[model samples]
Target: MEKMLSVWKTAPKAGLEVKEAPVPKIKDNEVLIKVKATSICGTDLHIYEYDPWAQKRIAKNIPYIFGHEVAGEVVEVGKGTGGISIGDHVSAETHIPCGYCYQCRTGNEHICQNVKILGVDTNGTFAQYVALPYKNAWINDKKIPHWIATAQEPLGNAVHTVFSGEVAGKTITIFGMGPIGACAVALCKAAGADKVIAIDRDEFRLGFAKEFGADVIINGATPGTDTRKEIMDATNGLGADVFLEFAGAPAAFNDGLATLRAGGRASILGVFPKPFEVDVTDGMVFKGITLTGINGRKMYDTWYKARSFLSTGKVKLEKLVTHRFKLFEIEKGMQILQKKEGMKIVLEP
Candidate 1:
């Protein structure tokens, strides 16, 4: 039996366990990968806390493995597979869209009606051995380390958000300095944004945000003397031309809207737990702002952009990796992630 780290349902709920599971077998047109590195995402924290999203969406009756950010080495390739060889380093797209879906046929496969996410719907990368369909896998240059390869998934979100609208030489303000938010800060700067403002409650994170090239950092929880005003003041009193919300906090959502200049664009990439009630009359409709919600990025489009960003030295991924763990220490890894104010943590299986 091969040992796997899995998110399982135990009494008191939200409980995840690491168990010794049978190694998976691959089908034709598939490859078996021995996981080398995987990262804990913000979604994992919600599952750990048994948030409403977890209780409602995740089936509690069965053992579920949760992880999507993964990179590994191919150990076995099934029959009929081509363009891949054993020992190749790879990462995969998590949104496995059914090609026959209406959205897929319309060139909107990112929102395909029938989508199977790797970790959430089935056993994911938390295991030592994971079998993936050939279509999901992408080969990386040999120099790219497994840790950086696993990070491509989340980094793709940053790439998608920054490029959603024109970012070159634009004034960008990012709210909620989480990992993805931090990624946005760096990406915006690298993309030639004139200014990038990083907002968060933690001073430590804001400090780290500077490492991502945040030109300005603000603490959002400082007893409310109008933090938006400070952001505007920092932006020469015109407000940010683009406001990106990476923190799903309802307050951050509202603040981001309030901080945008008239006719500016905004991107919402963070996952909020509840319905956000914002006054569309102000800043949105009246100001003629363009607002877009971001989901699982454009599969191949974002992938190509992210790989190019990594390969061309636009994004330095090594700075984002703050913690590492062997496969057996997954529980400890989860505990560190629960604290919430560190850089990326990679689990090695």
Candidate 2:
């Protein structure tokens, strides 16, 4: 057996174990990739911490490798993988759609009824190499660097959220400063948003969010801070034209709605721990606001938009990548992530 170093959730508990495991073998319809760079994601954090959600969903598959965001080079091409050849640079779409589903048949494969996430439902990419179906591999432009390519999957979430409605000349307020929120800031600027207001508790993240083109920054965690008033003031008392919810908190949900203008739009991608209360009458019904629940990227549509920004240099990810470590140093990066002290941390093989 050809062995490779992989990070695995060896026990049904928090933390992962790095070990020498057999390199994944590709199915006839799949391709084997030598991973160049991979990034830590919030989903990976949930699994690593063995949260309730991870315990319920991932525990059954306890001893599998776990990570999804990745960029790599094809090293072995399976016989049935059409058009994909050795040495092709690729990043995968995390949503693995079942081609025969109704959603897939209707061009909404990203929401395929039988969708199996790349890392969650199957073995994943936190290793020297990863293997997956060729359909999920998106070939990257040669000009894109490895770290930037590793970020494309998460960046697609930001694209799906920001572009859910009109962006050009609109005042957009994003609640959260995580990787996706950081990506949202840069993406809004690239799309020509007039003003981008960023709200977060973490100063470290807010500091760099400015460079990502956030016009106004607010620390919502500060005691008695009136984030709604600040956002209202930034938009000339008209409230923000759009609200993006990525904080995954009840307060952020209310703050987002409270600051949104009448008839405005809200795109929610945040995953809440559980359901909570809200004032729909005042915040939504009377206001006639449009709310779209974003699940994942719109398949290859979001991929193209994200690539255009990277290719044109409209969104530079260098600053967003706050820390880089060798693959074996995953612990250091995970600690920084848990402490909310790092943005997009990449690990190279």
Candidate 3:
């Protein structure tokens, strides 16, 4: 019997129990991974809190493991699997897209109409063993640290967001200092952004932002005051040329829109609590701002970009990792993330 941890019920509040489960069976085109490391994400926090979105998407079951940021060593490969073998280090794209879909054929598989996110739609990696399609697995430099390997999912988000727009030599303001926000700061700076400004309410996260090459760190407590003022002042009173909103709060989106420079590009990577109104007419017309939205990474395409960014050595992941926990102690990790104090938190299974 393969033992695993599963979220049987929504936290309904904050704390949820992990139920032990048997290891999953693998199909011919899939591989079984013994998870070495997994990271808690913002979505996991929302799942813990039993949000309406998760309620609709996640099946109501006794136990449902919800971890997408994962890395592991291949333990078994079913018949017909290619190249990958036992002991190979790997991380998955989480999103398993059906190649037959229109979006998939058009090269937009990331948003394929028929897509299944491992952690959300099916059994995820918060266990000793998980079965995944061979196509979604990505092999990295064997020397890559397990901690850094688990971060590929979030880092890919940073790549997809910052690189999608014109970021080179432009002043950019990042609206959140969460894990992905911090990653964006590093990506922006490494991509030759003229300046990088990080905004967040947490002083610790803001301080951590500095290590990620943030030229300026602003506290978002006084929304309409110093933070916004500093961002504007840093951009020659014009406002940031690009604003990447990683904070899911509506306030952050509003502030991002207001603080964007005329003809600037804005990328929205955050998931808001619910549908909130944004006065698009306020600055969208006058500013001529290009607003971009992000979903998951574009599988192999984005993964290749992210890996290149890491291989460059210009983007640092060492200092960003501040906390680590074991798989059974996932509860504690969740608590730390909920408190929003640490920079990057990793969990070992």
Best by TM-score: 2
Query: How do these models rank on TM-score, best leading?
Result: 2, 1, 3
**In candidate 3, what are the lDDT values of residues 1-349, reduced to their tens digit?**
7677654444444456677888888999999988888887777776776667766666454256677788899989998889888889999898899999999999899999989888877778777778999888888778888888888788899899888888889999898888789889989988899999898888888876888889988887854656667777888899999999899888888888888988999989898878998888877987788988989887668899899988787677756777888787887877777787666678887
C-alpha-based local distance difference test score of model 2: 0.91
lDDT of each: 0.82, 0.91, 0.82
Model 3 lDDT vs. the true structure?
0.82
lDDT of 1 by residue, 1-349 (tens): 5555544444437657777777888999889888888887877676767778877766642466677788999999999889889989999788888899789998888888988888777678887888888878888888998987888877888888889999988898898877788878888988899998888998767876888888888897768657788888988988889999888899888888888999999998988877868999986999999999898879688889888889988888878888888866767777777776566889887
Q: Model 2: runs farther than 4 Å from truth? A: none
Pairs with steric clashes in candidate 3: 7-63, 7-64, 8-62, 8-63
